[model samples]
Target: MSPYLLIQLAALGLYLFLVAVNWSALPEPMAVHFDASGDPNGFMSQAWGAVGIPLMVWAMFFGLTVLGRDPGFFARMKRFSPSGWRAWAEFNTLMGLGLLTVSSMTVLYNVEAIPGEWIGYSVWIFLAFAFLAIYRLASVGR
Candidate 1:
């Protein structure tokens, strides 16, 4: 499997593991959102908080991975040449991996497995790395 696929799988697996381990410990109505200062500012039922975001991440990853296998689809949408279409597909998959990482970390934070402050800082750092990855992948074969 591709490194991107492996990373996505590992992230999703880790998220599921974390959620399972913390399931019983988490409050009934969990904090799903945080303010700039890292305080919980928004909330949702524990079921949604634990499972909903991960499901969405999984769906997005699956969709992007499938799309990556069909360059013609992206080409038709964006007028990319074959190689450009391939690059776009890879970049989309990379973005999905990044989202999985961020979402997993956020879930961990919400479950109190990690420090609240780490969420914001880690997200910014992840964004920087994600941009770099996208730039490198998109520039391939150019």
Candidate 2:
């Protein structure tokens, strides 16, 4: 496997490990059962977890496949010379920053629901996508 694939797998493993370690501490339900549903942040946190976890997995696996097929991915990224790059950067920034913030805040607010185990998985997934977004955004080499 390529070094990049190794890194991706390792990250995935590490995240799973953390989630297992903290499983017992996390909240039982992982959601607002009653009136708490009105809490926007709380709702957002749950939404992030539901959406972010899958997104992270998709991005890492997809990105790995993409980069693997084109080992010169970095070169290609750096070669971008178009106004579209700005739009790409903005899109990624919005996605990465938005998801990262929501995920982080969810972990913070729902400490019970987000024990070390869940937190690890949720966060690592968020980070994976966030990393991809950041990389893509930052790759515009003028």
Candidate 3:
């Protein structure tokens, strides 16, 4: 198995574990959205936060893994696909980790395990990673 896939598997396992153990501790209406200052501005049921978000994350992992395996899938998009598998792996790893980070942070913040400032920071950090992924994709083949 690819190292990226293994890392993704580990991340997914950890995420599931976190949600399962914290299931009861999480508030009924968890804070699922935050404002510019990291204050909770929107809420959703714990069920949605715990289940719906993970579903989306897993969907991303599934899509990335499938596409990575068939490098040709990306090759079809000649304009952006990088020439090497490393670029693809990095893209997948960064994206999967980014999703897990935000979702896990949401859980931790709602349980008062982490401060609100970290919430805003995490989003910015991941946004940087998203841009880095694009840069790697664009630069690798050149």
**Most accurate candidate by TM-score:** 3
lDDT of 3 by residue, 25-137 (tens): 99999998899888999999998887787668777865677577685676766654435566777787888888888889999998899988898999999999999897987
Off by over 4 Å in 2: 29-40, 43-142
Which one is best on lDDT? 3
How well is each residue in 12-87 modelled by candidate 1, as lDDT tens digits?
7877787788788888788777777777788888777778875686767666766666656565545456566456
Q: Return the clash pairs for model 1, or none.
A: none
Off by over 4 Å in 3: 78-83
Ranked by lDDT from best down, the candidates are: 3, 1, 2
Of the two candidates 2 and 3, the one with more favorable TM-score, higher being better, is 3
TM-score, candidate 2, is 0.39
Tell me, what's the RMSD of every candidate? 3.0, 8.7, 2.1
Model 1 lDDT-worst window of ten: 76-85
| Candidate 1 wrong stretches, greater than 4 Å | 1-3, 77-90, 137-141
